[model samples]
Target: MSSSEPDRAVPDPRRWKALALLCVAMFVVNLDAQIVLLAIPSIEQDLGFTSGSEQWVLSAYLLTFGGLLMLGGRMADLLGRRRMFFIGTTMFLLASVLCGLAWTGEVLIAARTLQGASAAVMAPTALSILVTTFDEGSERNKALGIWSGIAGFGATAALLVGGPINDLLGWEWIFFLNVPIALILLGLGPVLLRESRGERRNAFDIAGAITVTLALVLLVYAVVEAPDAGWLSAQTLGLIAASIVVFAIFAWVETRSAAPLVPLRIFRNGTLVGGNIVMLLLGMIGFGMGLLVSLYAQQVLGYSALIFGLGMAVMTVMTVFGSAVGQALVTRVGFKPVAAGAMTLLGIGCLLLSRISPDGSYLGDILIPLLVFGPGLGGCYVAATIASQTGVAADEAGLASGINSAGFQIGGALGVAICSTVAASVTGAATGTVAINDGFRAAFIACVVFAVLGLAVALLLRANRPAASPAAPAAEDVPAPRTGAPVHAQAGE
Candidate 1:
């Protein structure tokens, strides 16, 4: 067998089953994030949640999920990916059930937090499994394309489905829907998924994990609160300052720790760093657009939830299509152009969206951008994900996947906070339809800026052919000192 090939022969039936289960899991987790957006109004009405507290339902989940992702990946490595996967799936199912049964906003928020944490554990491990199960090259690309597609497409699909489901059934059913899917995946997991673990000797970096988690949580909290508290508020300043301190400590800990939770050396590679930068930017632009667009559709356009969902459906379909196409072409053309082109398209789409006015129609104004933006985002996602994991070793795949996923989740939180702040600031003192359009335009312009930045980062990636196998290290890798400095050591130095 080739070096990149799996040691064991392909278990055809089992592999297909495993892929199906993983896809279902991906769909459920993503659906949870977006479905709630459409149902938020209903949830508030039913649970009597205050306006300020309602955002926590989504924020709490994102906070815990994003905060613990590195740790979850580390746990998967130490404990075993399959074990962690099963545990995560079970926890997610239980949390979904609790969310469905939640009577108060507090309980729903808590359940969502649990759901997010469990999702963090599951998401990275799923990618790791795909890497291990499929041989590198076409097979792996196809699997990853599907995986990435599910994550993006699921969110948009949730919006489409959530409105109808909530209207026909109830807000509870939005979560209850996960129960059946989770059960199916749980049943298939043991039989289809093989047992896998990372390098056994590396110790888990508990201190590094804790510090990083605290840093991200504090940072996200500060940003999220800035809109309500004002930028100059002491509470916001204190949280932001504390986050900076914690992150500095995290960097220090990673450098010295024998088994760093995040190996600082990984960032030294231009490809990895550049890829993650683009991913972060793409996340900010893409997610921010989704939030603002949804708000505009309902608030300004005066569209029903169902109509709003339908209007966004084109973006979802195109995203899936683009992912499929990008996966097929990435090996042939390489990641640089694909990423750069995608960002360019995304920038154009956002600029077009910025042109929207009170007289704009869904088909003419929204649909055009959705079409362009979906494909652009899909290309960026595939290229960035592949680039991040390109040279990662088998044992380190889980950690690499975790870091990439973290960039995306953190980007969403950051984007939402920043975009919301900008929109609020622009529209705060204004009134009526003009104010709404101004807020939307401000957010879209921000998206355009983010997209352009992503394109610039993508251009920094070297024009090199992608490797045929996971075993082949990315061209970006170079031998260096443990301190991440380029050096040549003597035998006895």
Candidate 2:
């Protein structure tokens, strides 16, 4: 059988159990992204982080994680999904330990970089494994719904628990918490996951991988540091220019490589392209909103960290409910309509949140918007993901998974930078409560703009259609990666 074919005729019975394990793994990845936000002050005091440099603690992780995701995904496809996942989980565990044990700011930042690198390996590989595990129709859609909901919940859950954890324990426990979870994943993974990989090509795309990785790292670094460096400063402009040049070089390398890291023709899949666009907009809103809300609650409203987290608890609950509903709706209707509806809700939520007053209470201003927003967030994740994966070949599943993740992460960096810059512009050396609240309100309005753009893109997505079978084409008919149509990678034959 071709490597693109599913190895099993009947689905694995352990798939559901495996899905639970994968979700747990995904939870940790999502949690780490925002848990540190609440603990930044404690971490700074403890580690003696310089005023400006403390941001590196977060940037360090985001940089490496976003940079290497594509390489990580392709490696999983080439090396073995299960093997890469195990390696990533073990590495993450060690990095978490290192993070907990660090006495210096530099050491913690180094450990965070390691943590991000490992996450780069884990996220896409886990999703690729999921793509391979379930049947691609309603079964996969259902599993993705559960997965997307938990994934959304993981981010908010960090907000829910991060403050309490930091207040009761220390910031170290935030990293250390991954210890038991990682150990559990390491133990359960081997038994639960079946090994799988794509066909091994004769030559590895070393140039393509290196160039693309460098390009992504530079891109992330540019946006992340733009707010501090001054968006129009030479440093920011230089890095952005350099990133574009390197990306151009990577494209050139792909066209010439014997085995390109990302086959250029993958762009031919219109659904995948449209889905990623929407996902990018979603990412802009998701992380940006979290940061803005946290800032408004604690910095403006004068709520304690623990209290703020507790106030946001409804977001987590509603996101879970939304995921379940969105998944069910997608199965019945289609991803396009569901995605459009979700974006509409998100836009409405943002509009409501854009009107927050300086003296606003959580019950009066924040809670309603979160209630309106959470389901849309949950549903949009599922819809966009399903859309991105549609028509992708099983052999390229890891690559597609990586692209989907990269879209969100890179978009998050951009979103946060844009929102932060906008807020800073509005606040402009003003520390007053009204000034800060105005900044927060303006940021929410920015989020509303993202939602509207996302909705427009969602409308443009191709209708949901069954993917073509890879086996339909003879070996000789398979076109070269650079020049031909995609070889649809249906999960089960």
Candidate 3:
């Protein structure tokens, strides 16, 4: 029997319970990414963070989260998904408490960094567990759809709850909010989750792991600092070069290692490759646009943080709606069409947003574009996720999940940097509101380009499509490994 056959034949009765637990884990991860934004003002005031240093509140989290994800994912595959999940959740719980108790800016930044590292471990491992638990067909699609919707809620929840929490309680509550969620995960994890790991290897690729992680850390750090330091500044260029050199070394190390941290061969899976590429673009467009919109609504249009968040609630609702529709469409038609259509919508939305005036109202300027963009955001995320994991071996699921998550995280950092740089370049020496509006317009145009590029790449999924089979492949049905990657399909090829 194939390794995966038994899983199909005797599905776990607790799969749904496990899924619910895993979704909570994802919600926490996604929530942290945005929740801090709303609380930044309060955190700065209480912690005495200077204007320049305040950004570390967000940067510290993104840096650790993006840098360590690959290592965390690999650890999940080797150490045990359940074990990693438990460990990560424990760390996250502790970090949250530390953040809430922090007396200074430095302490809070340090705690946020730890929180990001723990999330890196939890995000991919939880996803790997979900992928393994559900059969890769309609059932899996449905699970992913729900997962996407919850993730949307988590992202929006920051806006929905963050303002009130900051106003009523304090910035500390933002971190404290995670305490209950993490405790629940830790308490219920053993009862709901099963232990699983990848194939045993004689030697762990310690060198490869270290080098790749260093490379990613450098890359994320460079991008996060680029907007302020100047893209071509000596520091930014030096860091970028260092990252490239380390990555090259990692590639060389992978080629020579018997049991590589990430098998070079895994990149042969075309669907995984294409899906990650699209995911990167989605992250870039989504995050870049989000930052610009916040600036436009609050800085230019004179809206309160709480009110702006409430206005954005519609976008969140539409994102959930889009995720469900995308899931259903992918199950019937295929991921390519669904993905392409999503990018098209995003492009249109960006085009609309680019035309926003300095005196624009939320209803006239923002809500209309968001109405079109939210579904696209929801659909693209779901489709790319399903596409990325379509035909992976059960053992490597953790690795795949990590790679997918990393793409989005890193892409978001890059997108923000690029968009901010563009905006700054256009707004140089201009103190006028109209000049700032011009910068925002340029940033939206950049997002439009990202969407267009995503559309182009989504089309390539058709080249080596994997035929959909009703059942998991048997031992005899498993095909020989191919030199090139396959564009795996969940529906008819």
Give the number of the best model, judged by TM-score: 2
Candidate 2's TM-score reads 0.93
Q: What is the lDDT of residue 398 in candidate 1?
A: 73
Q: Kindly list the per-residue Cα lDDT of model 1 for residues 327-387, writing each as its tens digit.
A: 7777778889989988998999989999888766798778899989888878788888878
Count of backbone clashes, every candidate in sequence: 0, 2, 3
Error of 1 at 26 (Å): 1.8
User: For residue 209, what is the lDDT in candidate 2?
Assistant: 93
Work out the TM-score per prediction.
Answer: 0.91, 0.93, 0.93
Query: How does candidate 1 score on lDDT?
Result: 0.79
For model 2, residues 106-158, the per-residue Cα lDDT tens digits are: 99999999999999999999998888777677788888889888888997898
Candidate that would win on lDDT: 2
Mind sharing the TM-score for model 1?
0.91
Lowest-sum lDDT 10-residue window in model 3: 484-493
Cα deviation of 488, candidate 3, in Å: 26
Between prediction 1 and prediction 2, the one with superior lDDT is 2
Query: What is the lDDT, from 0 to 100, of the residue 433 in candidate 1?
Result: 76
